[model samples]
Target: RDIAPSDVLAAREAGATGVVLEAGATNSHALILARSLGLPAVIAVAGLLSSVTDGDLIEVDGNSGEITIGETVPASAPVAAGRATPSATRSSAPPVTRTTDGRVVRLYANVGQTADVGVALAAGAEGVGVVRTEFLFLDEPPSEQDQYEVYREMADRLAGKPLVIRTLDAGGDKPLPYLPVAPEANPYLGLRGLRLSLAHTEVFRTQLRAILRAAVHGRIMLMYPMVTNAEEIALANEQLLAARTELAASGEEAGDVAVGAMIEVPAAALRAEALARHAAFLSVGTNDLAQYTLAADRNNAAVSYLYSQTHPAVLRLIQATVTGAHRRGRPVAICGEVAGDVDALPLLIGLDVDELSVAPHSLERVRAAIASLSYPECVARTEAHLRDV
Candidate 1:
């Protein structure tokens, strides 16, 4: 069965060595958490539950997606064949990567919790791109002070690196136990992200206020998810202003924070020009954008073949977003699974993406890929891909 991000965290705390999920997308929050915590995981394993029982002595190979069941296994057998073991002597990549043609690209880490901050820094991440804040509201909504402590600690640990904190993106695939969300036929398209925040102004304000307060500790950027139109950004800014005013009236100090928007919906990508006018920066959520653009449920196996970030339609949308944002002199970032994909690095770089926020474990690989490419070649490849479209 599918697991939640909080469940992944709890499993880590319980000292679990690995995770096996019957169903989950590779880019799902739970799996992302698993990677962040360094837990070996294999998902979408059919018959996983029906074939195993408690104390079956099953061996799981996350890299190969192979499971062996027996009374005992050879201790000398390698779990992942040919996989390089972590070595202390491994050279660390630079925080920022420059292509052979002198184009610079920033590599950031997508973290889920405060603990992931140190790991990101150690992995040579230039900054923390997007902090998934839903983890704090999984069990129950945290008080403003509680949220403040976590956000502040993350900023403090970053030690002046830019930390982009995304507000609570709950209500759809991720539902909070404490918040009542009416069941809908299509939760993905239902009230979620900014819509959910707008519907619950108090909760939204509390989060904005906490983020604002945390800004005083270090460089912080506030990003809102699922913003489909300029009006949504305007409405969100209204709440942000209200939070700032409330903080000032209470004599609570707040620092300057840049506001950004996540372009996940196709509509948002098409209107990136307008959205760029409202947001300070734009980050592409290719996972949702690909699924939404293709009308393929990412979590559904039957339609999985249809879901691709490289598809011409998806690539055009990303190009449009980058083009639109650049017109307004706003930076654009890719913070989805494709950002870390070595094969997709050329495409993104060719499309002129400014930053890539990937899982911490993928930092070195992505950096290497960026260093091996030529900006002019990437641009030619991108043009070739978009030629007939």
Candidate 2:
């Protein structure tokens, strides 16, 4: 053992205690040397550290891989040998959207993968606000039935809860390697979402077929993203109708599915009232709204920090979109990273958002925050905070 000769010296100098060593690639000699020094030691479990982030005051249950942050109680906490068995706990309960008066607001998760569907439900999501079906069409494209199977599995797990599926939003940053899309210099400004899906008829047809197929099994709605004009909505409805016609010909009934669009771009946000006239609901993708509104590329690290959801201009647009949707009797939800921030929650509550979709990890913390503040206080505080920001 390399450190055997200096084990005592290391102890004296380093103030040694029980060492936690990663076993996968840890040097055996080092373990032996630490053992010689009479240091208590243990091997690191795979994936243990990966889940924990820096600056997170995390309570980790080694036995369950459960990590709780903020005020949320984790499902379980780690216990040492002979210690009392810890009661089952979760890092936090699912998040609740709060009104200014402290009324519970519906908060859901915008899931991308089937695996995430369970996580969102377990985290206390009211429903899956959004399911980007694009992930299903990656490489080695699965059959239409295969897509239906995945969607049905997720729908079954959600069990009567609202699940909004956005048909294949490919191209741009999410190009399919298998589908020969020529590299665009400005992919973000290029064809994507409903446009990409429509241009490629077979691709859009297959997705619509899969989604309609899954609709028979659950409470489902169809939504499109990156919409700019009314024609896109008209065209999208035509395609969906064609899908329904085809499914009926095949002896499969196309169940009722509400159609909607995302209000992300400035044009869409401006025309939200008109967009709502044609669609069932409107979801503001704040992530893209901020980027496109501020003319900032989120991926550009140089200016990424300047991306501010707190920007008054961006706030105005979001409020306008929410207000417009409500006026038209169309529900509005936000699916973005901002939904997870406790500070932003109040602002959102004040804005009268119908729902919020956030990451699973931040769910409980948000719930606790919501439970702590009344809607009036939240709005008052948000109003005051906006001035300072």
Highest TM-score, which number? 1
In terms of lDDT, the best-performing candidate is 1
Model 2's C-alpha root-mean-square deviation from the true structure amounts to 12.8
Candidate 1 residue lDDT tens string, 251-365: 9999899999999999999999999999999999998999899999877777888999888899999999999999999999999889988998889999999999998877877
Q: Model 1: runs farther than 4 Å from truth? A: 70-92
What are the models' TM-scores? 0.93, 0.74
C-alpha RMSD values across all candidates? 3.3, 12.8
- Which lDDT value does model 1 have at 139? 87
Q: Candidate 2 residues 1-389, lDDT tens each?
A: 12221342354245444344233212232333333233444444445466444333444443343444444334474423221111213435534555446577788876656766766666677788878665544565667889889889988998999998987766655566545567688888888778877777776777788889999999998899888877899999898889989999999877789999987788888888888899999888887788888887755545766787767677777788887888899988887667767888878887778788765545566666777778887778667766743
Summing lDDT over every window of 10 consecutive residues in candidate 1, give the lowest-scoring window.
80-89
C-alpha lDDT of residue 351 in model 2: 76
